[model samples]
Target chain A: MALGLALALLALVLALVLAVAWRGTGLALGPADWAAVRFSLVQAGLSALVSTVLAIPVARALARRRFPGRGALITLMGAPFLLPAVVAVLGLLAIFGRSGLLNRGLEALGLPTVSIYGLHGVVLAHVFLNLPLAVRMILQGWLAIPSERLRLAGSLGFGPSEVFRHLEAPMLREVLPGALVVIMVVCLTSFAVVLTLGGGPAATTIELAIYQAVRFDFDLGRAAGLAGVQLAIGGVAALAAWGLYRPTGFGAGLDRRLEVAAPAGWRLWGDGLVLGAVTLFLTLPLLAVLLRGLPGLAELPAQVLPAALRSVLVALVSTVIATALALTLALESARRPRGLIEAAVTLPLATSGLVLGTGLFLLVQPLATPMVLALPVTVLVNTALSLPYLYRVLLPETRALQADYGRLAESLSLSGWSRLRWLVLPRLARPLGFGAGLAAALSMGDLGVIALFAGEGQATLPLVVGQLAGAYRMEAAAAAALLLVTLSFALFWAFDAGGRRAAA
Target chain B: MLQLDHLTHAQGDFRLTADWSANPGDRIAVIGPSGAGKSTLLAVIAGFLAPTGGAVRWKGHDLGPVAPGQRPVTILFQDQNLFPHLTVAQNLGLGLRPDLRLSPAEQARVEEALARVGLAGLGQRKPAQLSGGQAGRAALARALLRARPVLLLDEPFAALGPALRAEMLALVREVADQTGALVLMVTHDPEDARALGGETVFVGDGRANPPVETGTLLANPPQALQDYLGRK
Candidate 1:
């Protein structure tokens, strides 16, 4: 019955997206909307290409080289994805923005000044957001090459290239297509990054175009049309990606740290450079965000507290909803083993957030104003959005529990609530906490949906920060962004820490 | 009698068939080659896997519809017999009450079971804190507490040293003596089968034959059994 409710909710939400997207009588794609579509594909394609190609070396380097902080570095690879996109943009802008560190460095070097806006800036941020994920995926690919295979290569007098050809390349071939599709789809639905960094009309993504049609034009017809384009694009891509998306099992299992012969001489330096440069690219912006945001912290605006509290409430409630749905769906699917239910839960990952918000907007706008409906819509959409991550964390643990101890529990006469309480719940504690924490953090900083649903004075922390930035309140915006990051990270850290300690 | 009545289980290319029966307090060693039907027989009897044909009956009652936990059976695998995260008492407590919600008297029973297994002072310790033999003892304590009519040991101490395994078998023998359970054990070692003693069921070529006296079976083995023993 619980499973039915969660599944029904998932089905209805998806049905709503499809309904709204296809609701209008005619499908018209304007030049501007078409530009949005083209730009979305190009940037996502470029981002996917760059991140994957670059990830190969980093992953290869990580696979063979077991240095100090390697474990920490790998853990940190997962951190960037959890970063709220708004904070990441703020971080990136602090480094690559016009008056930022990179331009300053270039100025000092007597080189031409570069801007962190428009097409390249958008691509850069997308790559920044995605490269670590790519590296981690590809690194898992490299580490997955059994030591026995490398030993065989060594015994057969195969050099590095031979090993790469005979061993590494094939694994990469298997792993990359999935990684590319996933990253592109991720890039396709991107709102916060594109909205912030791609400041010009020429750089508008389909998602950004949806936001524009709703926010600026207030043209439901145009908005629905653009949303249809996004839905069609996102849906098709997501479907293809879903078929291909097997997560490269990075950071899973104890044996990720394997010993292999790294390449010699220049290859060594090349790998080192990739590792060094990627680290710098990832870390510098966060550092910049930190340094700039810190000075403005003491004078945070009075508006910060209420927004933060509201955001927290939304985050906490949405987390509970997401966690509940994830557990229910995961448990049911694991029990009955249904493919369709699993697919429905994850379908939101492929749908555009703006489109989802727009669909809900189309559904609710006539009955109630967007502002009154804003927080609830935000909560609902965030739950839908966060369900995938929750599933990712919980499903494996739940399935493994069933595999390893299901019989034991059954044989012990543990059934239903007894089995769940004694065996399943206790065993699932860590993943449950982690999943809840992920949902909390994601919802906390989610600037999606809220953009369309939020009326005047209904801004979330991310929305407010964006507004502050738009109004050129740079210091306050930086400070507010810092607060957002801190709150999100603290919530994640607390739940993650709580889980670890409980597991301990 | 604990009966395996014309049982058959087939998965892909592997098929296992068994027809065996044992009286109360019988010690039966199921001996077979590594990939043979030894454990499969025990699994069917314990209700972990359904048989392709016939039923398992205990004391003239068909055990087919019974869930694994509710059946007159207690089975232990080679290892991971206790969840590492749980205290020894809690792990043992599960055998008494699946919920581990023991009243004071029931808790005392858990303590008594622990003491009976030579783990009197170690009930508070987690599985990780216990040595291999001690962990095995904890598993035995749970099995003892449950006092199921049939005890199935799937080489539960196979990882233990020879001395420890012998000690575990001795404890199992004592537990079976107390509980009057039919002890069905799967072991590759001929010595273990001999040590278990009473009767032996030699499983190979997709069939588990009925038990004969262990000494008689070992002395005059079938061809498949002789080949397996010789190969080992």
Candidate 2:
């Protein structure tokens, strides 16, 4: 039944979105809309290229070299990927905004003040956000090399170039396409980053265009058309990612520091330089956000607290819904390996927040005001978006559990609620908790659907940050971004720690 | 009586056919080679898999509609006999009530089964905390608590040492005696079948031959049985 509901929900949303887009203005793409499409593709392509290329040396350094903070640095690499996009944008702006540290330093050195807006700014923020993910993916490839293979290379007196040729280059070839495609799909549908730094006709992305069409112009037809284009790009990218992506077994052996060929002299300094520069680039903006937000924390605007409360509420509700739905889909699929449920769970990956929000807006406008339903709509969209991740996390564990214990539970007369409470829940607690934490954090940090539906008073924290930053209230924006990041991480840490304790 | 009435199970290309019945409290050993559908036969009886062509019956009633847990049977696999996350007592308690909502009387029964299985006062330990033999005892203890009319063993003690395996087989006999369960134990070892002391059912060549006396079958073995024993 839950599997039925999951498939039905995805089908219904896609049908409605497509129906509205198809029914509106005969699906015309204006010249400016075409421009938005071009900008979206170009920026995503550049971001994927730059992030993947830059991540190679850094992943190599981390994979081979051991230093005092090497373990800590690898752990920190996971932080930015989970860091809310709005918060990361605030951090980036704190360092690279017009009056930020970079501009001030350039003034001191008599160089021209550079603008952190348009194509370059969007790409920079994306690289900062996705660079860690790219590095981790590639590092998994490096670490996955068999110890026997590495030993053979060493015994054969392989040089660095030879090692790269025989070993590293092949691993990269197998891993790089996956990393590049995943990053491209991520950036293609990214709304918060582009909305913050990307503006004007030349820089607008499809998502931002959808938001503008809905909010400023009240042009539902145009929003629907843009959503169609967004869907096409996302569909193709998601398919490519699905085809190319390999698990890399990144979950295990990340901490097993391999003794690879870390040569001395120039190579040693070169690895150190790569590690240092990457660390500073990733950490400086975060530090600036902290340094700027501290004073404003004492005198946060009164509305920030309510907004925070609203965001937490949304996160909690959506986390529960996504976790429950994913559990249902996973268990049913594990019991009977059906393609329908798998397709339902994964289909949401090809649908964006703006597309769902716009279609839902068209559906809800005839019945009631979309503003009044903002938080609920946000909850629904967040649940749909995060369902795929939680499903992926739980499916393998659920399969293993069923394979091992399904018969035992069955022969013991454990069925229905009792089976779930006694057998499934305890067995699956770790993955359940971890997946829930991720869902909660993602929902809490989401600025997508709410941007389209929120009236003046119904703003979420990410929306509030965007508002503050847009008004040039950098200090207050920093403060809200700080609050948002703290709450998101806190929610994640609490759930994750709870899971570990339970499993222990 | 338990019946495998014209039971034929097919999965893809593999098939197993059996047409036999056993009296209540009868002991039978299902001995066969690897990939001979020994486990699949046990699975069909335990209601984990449906027969492709016929029905399973208990005491003249068709068990086709019964769910695995509701069937009048208990099956112990070779390993993972106990859930590792559950304590020994909770694992036993699940046999009494799926919800683990034990009344005071039922809770005492759980403790009694633990003591009966030589796991006395160790009911609080999780499966991980138990040794391999102790884990086998815990699973047997749960079977005792369940006290179903039919018991099926799929080499449940194969992981134990020789001495421990012998001891577990004795315990299985005791548990079967106490509950009056018709026992069907699947084993590859002739010594195990001999120790089990039952009518032997040879499952091979796409069929499960009905029971012959274990001692007689071993003494005047058929050609296929001779080949299997000789190869080993």
Candidate 3:
């Protein structure tokens, strides 16, 4: 009942805003809105299509082959999922920006300079973030194909091409649509990436436009109207994607122990080269951030420490809140099987943090003092924003647990507090810990809520980095960026370790 | 004492109607075909399901208004008997008290229970560290700690080998004897009924029968029991 009320309140607010903005703004759908809408769709479509397509061979190789550093490589595939958008953008800038490492190297070699702005930079950042995600998802798909089928194909003297034609292709066709939809939804709300790398008119996304309308123009009517448009587009996209989506695999009892054999000598070398080049491309910018920031570490003690402390405090509170909400929702959903609540939990994924931040600001600023409520409001927004990720991490485990343990506990009269303590909490400790770590790391690197609420003395690390960049404090920003990256990673690692210990 | 009067439950395509009763010390084994809803009957009795039309009474009081955990009953499931994250001692402790804050003597009781289950020194081990038979014993031990008047087993030892299954069945009988609890177990195996020597209740065709002598039922069974056992 409480969950339903919370969702109802959110929906009512959105509906009220839509009704008022529609009446007062007189904001008819216009050409500019249409252009922004078209650009958003095109960018998301191209990004998803490209990332999934490129991930196929890589995922196949990774799933089938085992070599040295396999654990590290697989772990690296999960890195981008945890990496903050703003931190990733900074790293990309350190490698691709005008005075960046690559451009400087090109200048030293007397070669032509490459521009890192506009569509190319946006696409680059998208690919950097989405590529690993796509690879992991697709690899999970490939790993799911029962090995007995492959062994039968091998026994029947089917060649590699024949096997792929019959088995792998069909599997990919089944998995691709869902993966594409997921990636498309993620890209549709692309905010920090576009804000940082999207140069001008040519690269602006609808999300960036909405942010501009609210922050720069202070046109509440226009912002509210744009918000309506944004939600409409998101709703339509989600509906279309829902039409195309299909469940990929059950993903239970997958052959985690299966190892792909290396190909013969030259073939192995070629595979290695492709893997190395892709990894280098993905990792170079992170390297640049580290290299550049190392020299500025002495200067970091002044501002970075305070910002780091604030980030830690915010991350801890938000992560705990997100975890609690996610666990409650997961448990409730398990008990009652509410599809609408699950969908509501995921709605934030399709909506950008900027849009949510704007809504929260508008809704709360009228009721409370912005200065006093800033920190809590920031934490609240961050927790709500992270609810989807935490829910995703916790839901699968919760469902599996209910399937396995529900009857036993119930028959034993384990429900309510007793059920949670004896069965649910204990079984879910691992996933809960993991989800909390992810929430913490994500909250730590968040710049969206902080961007809107933070004043001079109230900045988080990512916001501090953004401010430093705006002030042309390149070295200091780089140092702060490095610190942010380390902090986020450390937070995740520590929480994950704690989760493991709890499980142990 | 427990009673189920015209208990009927529908789960998706599966439906069950049970009319039965057991006295304080009666042990009933519900045997049925795979989809015959034996577990569903137990679930309805356990308060895990709201029957479409029926009444469950315990000790002359209607159980319709009581929640599952609050009932004077404990059940051991087929698998996932213990919480994976908790040590065996902690799992035992949870059955004694949900908050799991125990006094020294209360903690000693948990230790004694573990020792009774042959897991005294293994209390620190998580469920993953325990073997299948050990896990089953641990679950039984936890149920015993609950001190409930009714015990339910949902094919709890079906996964164990013949020897281990027999051992666990013996342990269950011993616990029930000591506690003077009514035991309701669901099983497909005639050997299980024979080994436990409980009253057999044949469940089939969307309904359950009253308890009959296990030895007589197995030796000179009705057509439904014959068919059910023949298939198995």
Give candidate 1 regions above 4 Å deviation: A1-6, A60-75, A101-115, A148-171, A199-201, A246-276, A332-336, B219-232
lDDT of 1 by residue, A204-279 (tens): 9988887887888888777888787777788788888878887654377524535456668998888788778878
Candidate 1 structure quality by residue, lDDT tens digits, B1-232: 8977887899999998877789989999989888897878888888988988888889889888888989989999876778777789988888888878899999999999988988887888988888889989999999999999899999989999999999989999999999999999999998998998789998889888899899999888888888988944
Best by TM-score: 2
DockQ of each model vs. true complex = 0.57, 0.82, 0.51
- Considering TM-score, which of the candidate structures 2 and 3 is the better prediction for this target? 2
Residue A23 lDDT (model 3)? 37
- Which ranking of candidates, highest lDDT first? 2, 1, 3
Superposed Cα RMSD, model 2: 1.5
Structural similarity to truth (TM-score) of each candidate: 0.91, 0.98, 0.89
Clashing pairs in 1: A411-B69
Clashing pairs in 2: none
When 1 and 3 are scored with DockQ, the better candidate is: 1
**Per-residue lDDT of model 2, residues B3-28, tens digit only:** 88999999999999999999878889
Once superposed on the true structure, which residue ranges of model 2 sit more than 4 Å away at CA?
A: A247-251, A257-259
Worst 10 residues of 3 chain B by lDDT: B223-232
lDDT of each: 0.84, 0.90, 0.77
